[model samples]
Target chain A: MLNPVIEMVDLTKKYRSFTAVDCLNLTVGKGEIFGLLGPNGAGKSTAILMMLGLTEPTSGMVSVCGINSTRNPIEVKRKVGYLPEEVGFYDNPTGMENLLYTARLNSIPESEAKKRAEELIERVGMAEAKHKKTGKYSRGMRQRLGLADVLIKKPEVIILDEPTSGIDPQGVRDFLQLIVSLKQEQGLTILFSSHNLHQVQQVCDRVGIFVKGKLQSVGDIESLSKQLFTESLCLIEAGIHEFPAENTDTKPVRKLLEPINGIAKIEHKKGVFEIECTSDLSATIAQTIVNAGYGLNFLNKKEYGLDEIYNRYFEGGIQHG
Target chain B: MKEGYNMVKKKVSEDTTGNQKKVKRPAKEKPKHPFWVIVNKEVSDHVRSWRFIILVALIALTCLGSMYTALNNMGDALKSSKTGELFFFLKLFTVSDNTLPPFFVFISFLGPLLGISLGFDTINSEQNRGTLSRVMAQPIYRDYILNAKFTASMIVISVLFFALGFLVMGLGLIAVGIPPTAEEFLRVIFFIVLSIFYVALWLNLSILFSVRIRQAATSALAGISVWLFFSIFFNMIVDLIAKGLAPSSFAPEYVIVKFQKMILNLMRISPAQLYSEATTTLLMPSVRSTGPLTMEQVAGAIPSPLPLGQSLLVVWPQVTGLIAVTILLFALAYVAFMRKEIRSS
Candidate 1:
C-alpha cells in the first residue's frame, strides 16, 4: 500500500462558533498530483494552512510526512512548500532576491540555494522577471515568482492553494504545465487546490472535492465520476433537435451502437443526450456518430469537470449543511 | 501489468519517503536557521532604511546647528570685558546673568521627536507589508522578533545620541581651542545619557501607543500630543498651580522653595523636563555648586566634571527608568502582536 505523505484524520478548524473545516480527512500519497477541488470559502485554503501548520486545527490529527504537524509545525514547514492563493512578497526585493531570502529562511545552504533558485525560476518560466522587483510584476508573474520562492528548499511536499486562480488563460496553462512537469520530473508530491476544473482534471492523479468545509468525495476522477453518478456517461450531441429521432427502429440505431457493451441507459435534454454505461464507451459512440450520416455536433466523455463538480458537490453540500 | 502495478505502488512510496526525508532532520533536532535569519533580516533592513538614515542625519544637523549657535554666543560674551562667571553663564542663553542655557532648550525639544519617529511605525510597516505573518511563521519564538526590532531601534537611537555628543565636543574644542578636561568630558557624557533617556522615554511611550493603537498615524499623533503637552503647556500649568496654591504671605525664599519642589515634581513625570534639569546640572558648573558660576564652564563642564561614580548616581534613575519603560512597552507590543491572529487582511 502507498504511504500517505500528508494526512488529515478528522481534522477540524473552527473560528469561534464558525467551523471553517469540519472533521476533514484527507491523504495525498507520494509522487502524485492530488487536486483539492473546491469553490471559494470551501475550506480548501484552511485545510492547506492546517497541513502546513500555519493555522491550528480545532480537533483531530494532521501529519505531514508522518510528523504530527501541530506538535512539530516547524518540522512540517521545512518539508512542505506552500504557495498561498494570493501570493504576497517583500515588494522591495527583486524576485531572485526574495527567493534567495526565503531559501535562507528555510535553511538551505547559500550555494545550493542559489542553484535551486535559478533552476526553479527557469522551471517556473520566471527567469526573465527574476531581477525585477516583485512589486512591479503582473499578477500572473507574481504567482510564478511565488511558486519559485516556494520551491527554494525543494520541499518534499508542495501545497499550492488556487495556484492559478487569477492568472490569464495562457498563464494558467503554463502554470499547470509546470506543475505537470514537476510531478513527472521531480516526482513532486503536490496537493493543489484550484477552481479550474479542466486543469485539475488534466493534471491530478486523484482529486478530493471539498464543499462548504466538507470533503464530499475523494478518489481518482474516473472512480469519482462513477461513484457520484453511478454510471459512465457520454455526452452525445447531434443535429435535428432529438435523439432516437423518428428512425428509432432503423438498422443504423441497432447496428451502429446497441451491441457494443456496458451501456445501462440513455436520456436526452435539449440538443445533448446522455448515455449511462457500465463501461466507458466514449470512443465507440464518437466513432458511431461519425460513421453515421448524422452531423456530430459534439461527442465527449462525461467526466465531471471541476466547475460542474464544484456546483454539484459545493452547492449540494451547502444545501445539505 | 504486474510491473506497472509495482511501479505505481513504488511511486506512492517514493512520495511519502521524500516527505519523510525532509521531516526527519527537524524532528531530530531544533533548527537554528529561523532565529538567525530573522535577526539578520531585521537588522539589515533597518540599517538600510530611509528612516534610520534621516534619524542620524537629523541628529547630526541639529547638533551642528546648536553648536554653531552656542559658539556665536560665546564669541559675543568674550568680546565684552565682562568675562566674569555671571556674564558667561547668562551669555550661555540670553547674554544675561539670570537664565538657563539655550542649548538645554534645544535638547529638551529635539530628543522626543527623534524618539517618537523611531518607534511610531516599527510594527505598523511590517504589518502593512504583510511580512509580519510570514515572519511569525518561522520557527523562532515571537519574543525574539520583538527583541530584534527593539534592539535595532535602540542601537539607532544610541548611535545618533553619541554622534551628536561627539559633534558638540568637537565644535566646543574648535571654538574654545582646548579639548574638554576629563571632568568636563564626564559631565558631557552624563548629559548625553540624560538627553537620550528623555528621547527613549518618548520612544517607549510611542511604542506602547503603537501596540495599543492599530494605526501608525494615530500612534504618531499621540506621541506628538504628549510631547506638546509636556514641552509647551506643562510649564504654564505648573506656574499657575504654584501661584494659586501658594500662600499670599509666602516670602521670596519660601516662594523659591515652593517653585523648586513643584518643578522637581513636574520633571519627575516628564522626561523632557528631567533631561533639561539634568542637562543644566551637567553643563552649568554653577548649578552643580548650587550658586552663581561662570558661562564658559556651562558648555565646558559638559565633557567631564564630577567623579564617574557621582555622575552615574546623578542620572542613574533617568537611564534606568528610560530603559525599564522601553522594555515594558516592547513587552506589551510582543504580547499584543503574538495574540493577534495574522489574518488581518
Candidate 2:
C-alpha cells in the first residue's frame, strides 16, 4: 500500500463571511494523475493555492510528501512543481535565461543548471526559439516553456492549474500528451485542475468533482455512475410493423413490466421502449418483451459517460445548497 | 494471504525509506542564500535600465556645471586672498558663485528623484508583470524578495554617490593643485553617507507606496507628489501655521523665539530638510547649530569654525532623526508587503 503523496485534512478557507473552500478532505496517492473537475469559481484555484502554501487556509491542514505545508513550506515547495494557470515569465529575458534564473533559485550548480536548461528547452521543443525573448512567443509556446520551467527543478509531485485553458484543440492534445509522457518517464504524481470534462476524462485515472466549494463526488466514471444511479438502464429498440397506436393496446406490456420487482421506469419513444431497473432485471425485461410477441429488433444497455454524471452531481449539488 | 500482506507492507516501508534517503543526499551541498540571488538579479536589472542611466547622466552634468563655476570663483578668491584657504578641497563641493548653487546643494535637492525613480515601480511593476507570485513560489522565505530589493537599491545608490564624490574630488585636485587634508576627506565621506541615508528614506517611502498601490504610474505620482509638497510648499505652509499660532511680530521676544522653534521642528519632519541641515553642518564647519541661539547663549562663544568632532555633535540629532524616519518608513513598507496577497491579476 503506497502512502498518498498529497493530503488535505478538512481544509477550509473563508473570505469574511463567504467560504471559498469548505471543509475539504482529499488524498492523492503516489504516481497517480488526479483531476480536479469543476466549473469556474468552484474553489479549485483556491485549494491549489493553499496546497502550495501561497495562501493561508482559514482552518485545517495540508501536507505534501508527509511534510506539513504550513509548518515548512520551503521543504514542500522543493518537492512540488507548480505550473499556474496562464503562466507568465519575465518578458525581458530569453527562454533560456528564464529557466536559468529558476534553476539558480533552486540552487542547482551553475554548470548543471545550464545543462538541464538546455536539455529541457530541447525536450519541450522550444530549442529553435530558446534565445528569443518570451514576450514574442505565442500562447502555445509560452505554455510549453512554462512546462519546461517547472520541470527544470525535477520535482516529484507536479501541480498544474488549468494548463490547457486557452490553447487550441491540437495544442491541448499535444500539451496533455507531453504531461502524460513526463509522468511515465519520471514516475511523477500529477494533480491538474480543469473545467473541461472531455480532457479530464481522457487523462485522469480518477477525478474529484467540486461544485460551489463542495466536493460532489470522487471516483472513476464507472464507479461514480454506479454510485449515483444505483440501477441499470436497458433500451429496447423494436421495429414493430403491427404496433398498436392506442394507449389501451400497450396496457398488457405495461402491466407485465409493472408486476416485476426491480423495474423502476418504462417509457416508450418512437418505436423503442427504455426500461430502467436494477442490474439483474435487464434480462427479465428482454425475455418478457419477446415472449409478448412484440418485435424486439435491438436491445442494448446505455453506458453513462462523465458528462451525464457531472451534470447529475452538479444539479444535485445546486438543489442541496 | 496473511504472510503475503506482511511481506508487501515491509517492501513498501523499505521503498519509502529508501526514497527519503535519496532525497536527503543532496542536503550536503548547501544552497546560496536566496537574498543574494535576488540582490544579484535586481542589481543587474537596475544597472541595465534606462532610468538609472538617465538619472546618473543628469546628476553628473549638473555637478560638473556647478564644479566649473565654483572652480573659477575659487581661482579668483585665491588670487585676491579674500576667502580663507582652510579646507579648500571641501570648498569645491560647497562653494557657489553667481551662476549656480554648490554641488552638495544640487544633490540635496535632486537626490530624492534618484531614490524615487528607482523604487516607485519596484514592487508594482513586478506585480503587474505577473512575476511576483512565481518568484515567491521558489524555495525561499517571503520577506527575502523585499529585503533583497531594498538592499540592492541601497548598494546601487551608494555606489553612484561614491563614484560621483570621487570624480568631484579628482577634478578638484587637478584644478586646485592641492590634496584634501584628512579632516576634509572624512567630512566629505560623512556627508556622502548622510546623503545616502536621506535618499534611502525616500526610497523606503516610495516602496511603501508601491506595495500599497497596484498601478506603477499611480505610485510614482504619489511619491513625486509627496516630494514636491516637502520640497516646494511645505516650508511655506509651516510658516503660515506658525504665524497663525504665535504671530511672531505681535508676540514678545520669547514668543517669537518659540514660534521660530516651532517652525524649525515642523520643517524637520521632512527628510529633505533634515538632509540639508545635517550636510550643511558637516560640510560648512562654520555652522554651529540648527536652532536659533539667544543673545546670552552666544555672548561668550567664539566665532571660530568648530572641529570635525564638534560638527558631528551639532548634527547628530538631525542624523539620528533621518535614520529613525528611514527605519520607520521601511518598517511600514515591510509590513505592507508581507501582508499583501501574492495573487497575479
Candidate 3:
C-alpha cells in the first residue's frame, strides 16, 4: 500500500465463548476505496466498530490515521467518520438539527456548523428533506442524511457499514458515485462495508472478502481473480455462422480444432462452442477456425467477476486449514 | 491542539457560505465546552418534552391547591395553636386541611415521580433512537453523555423546586400581609433543598436502571417498582421483622429500647423515610427530634422553636443519608454506562 490510513493487525473481538471478529490483518491505503465485502453475519460490522473504537477488540490492535483506536478513541473518532449499519438519527429532530447536534458534539462553532450542515445536506441530495423530522423519512432519505452527517465533521477517513443495505438500486448507484467523487475531490480514504458484491466491484479500488469472522482474501478484483482462479485456467467462447449441431459440418469443425495449443476441453451449447483452455488460446483457436474455412462471428475470453469468486470460495468453505 | 480542528472547519464553512454569514459573533470564538454543550442540549430537550410539561403542571396545580387550603384554615390554626405560631409564612407549606396534604407531603409523594419521569428513559431512549452510539462516536469522552444527562435533569429539578418554593413564598407574602423573617425565609429555602435531594435519590435510581435495562419501558417500570416498594411495603416489611425479634416483651428495658432503635434504623433505609424526616425538621421549627428522646433528654429541651442552624443539625443525618444514596447510585450508573458497549444492538 502507498500509505496505509487504516491498519488492523491480528485484531480479534470475542463475546465470551464466541468470536465476532477473528484475527484479521488488513491495510487500506490513503485515498483508497476499500470494500469490506461479506455476508450478513460475517463480522464485517464488528470489524468496522473496532476500527472506529466503538467496540474494544479482545486482542491485538486496530488503528486509524496512525492512532491506536483503543488508546485514543476520541482522537481516532475525530478524524474518522463512522456511519454504522442501520445508521439512525434523533427521530424528533429535523435532519438539519441532527447534523447540527453532531457538529456541536464535534465542537464545531454554531455558525460554522450551520454552514457545513447546509452544504453537506445539499451535497448528499438531502437539501429538500433537511427540514423534515427524521422519523418521517423513508429508508433512502435516512441514508442520505447519514452520509451528510458523516461529512459534516470533515473527517480524513470515512467508514460506512452497509450504507446501501436498504436503498433502492438507483439510490445505491448515486450514493456510490457520490462517495467515489468525494474520495477523488477531497482525497478521503473510505472503508465501505457491504454485502453487495456487484456494487463493491463497481466502486472499490480493492476488496476484502470476509467470511465467518475471518478475512478470506484481500486484493483488487483482477489480482484476486488471478490469485484464486489460476488452477481453473480460463474459459473461451467462439461463435461461427454454421456452428449448430443440426448441420453435419459441426463434427468436422470440432475435429479441425483439436490441434490448437493449450486447449483443454470443448462443450457445444446450442450454437456457441465453449473452449476451455489452460491459457490465453483465443488467438490460436481463432486462427485455426478461420484457416479451416469456418466463418467465425465472435470470440471472447471469460474473466472471473466478484460473484463467481464469492460463489466458489463461499461454497468451498473459506477456511482451508 | 486538536481543538484547532474546529477553527479550520469554520474557515471551510465560511468559504462555502460566502456572503451568507449571518452570525454577528466573532468567528474566532472558542468552542464551547462539550460537556456544557451536551448538558444544555439535554436540559432543553427535557424542558420541551411533553412529560416535563405535564409534570410541571401536576406539581404546580397541587402546590396551589394545597396553599389555598392552608390559607383557608390558617385563622383557625393560629387560634388553636398552643405555641401561638408567628411565622404564618411557613404555614403556607406546612398547614393542610384534612382533605389535602401539605406541600412537603405532596413533594414526598410526587418528587419521586418527577425524578423518575425525567430520567427513566435518559439512556435507553437514546439507545433505542439509535442516537447514543452516534453521539458516543463523537470526540467527547464516554462519561460525558451520562454525566450531562444527570446534570441536566438535576438542573431542571432544581429550577422547578426553587421556582415553586419562591412562588409560594411570594404568594404567602400577599395572602398573609407580612413578610417572612430571615429565619423563616432560610427555613423554606432549606426545605426546598431537602426536597431537591429527595428527588435526586430517585433520579439516580432511575438513571441507574436506565443504564442497566435495554428497554425504556422496562427501566421506567423497574424504577417505579422500587419507588413503590420503598414508599409503601418497605415499612410494613420492617414492622414484620421487628415483631419477629421483639425481645419477647420480657427482656430488660435496655434490650427493648435497643430493639426499637434497630427497627427505626431499618425503616430509615427507605428514601421516603429519610426525605420526610429531613423535610419535617426543616419546615417546622418547633419539631425537635427525628428519633425518640428519653425523658431526661426531652426535659432539658425548651419548648421554644429551634434556630435555623439547629434545625439543620437535626436534619443533618437524613440529609447526608439522602445525598450519600444519591451519589452512590449515580456512581453505579456512571460505571455501568462507561463499560457499556456502544453497539446499537
Task: Locate the minimum summed-lDDT window of 10 residues in model 3 chain A.
Answer: A312-321
Query: How does chain A of every candidate compare to the true chain A by TM-score?
Result: 0.83, 0.84, 0.94
For model 3, residues B56-127, the per-residue Cα lDDT tens digits are 999999999999999999998899877886666788898987799998999999999999999999888888
**lDDT by residue for model 1 over B51-114, one digit each (tens)?**
7678667656655665566666676556763324332332332222223335557667777887
**C-alpha local distance difference test of each model:** 0.71, 0.85, 0.88
Model 2: residues with Cα > 4 Å off, grouped in runs: A231-302, A315-321, B1-31, B76-83, B246-250
Q: DockQ each candidate and list the results.
A: 0.16, 0.37, 0.62
Residue A293 CA error for candidate 3 (Å)? Answer: 5.2
Cα lDDT of model 2 by residue, A185-211, tens digit: 988999989998889888898899988
Best by TM-score: 3
True contacts kept of 3: 0.70
Instruction: State the local distance difference test value for candidate 3.
Output: 0.88
Assess the local accuracy of residue A250 in candidate 3 as a C-alpha lDDT between 0 and 100. 62
lDDT of 2 at A34: 92
Sort all candidates by TM-score, best to worst: 3, 2, 1
Question: Using DockQ as the measure, which candidate wins?
Answer: 3
What does candidate 3 score in Cα RMSD to the true structure? 5.3
Predicted structure with the largest lDDT when compared to the true one: 3
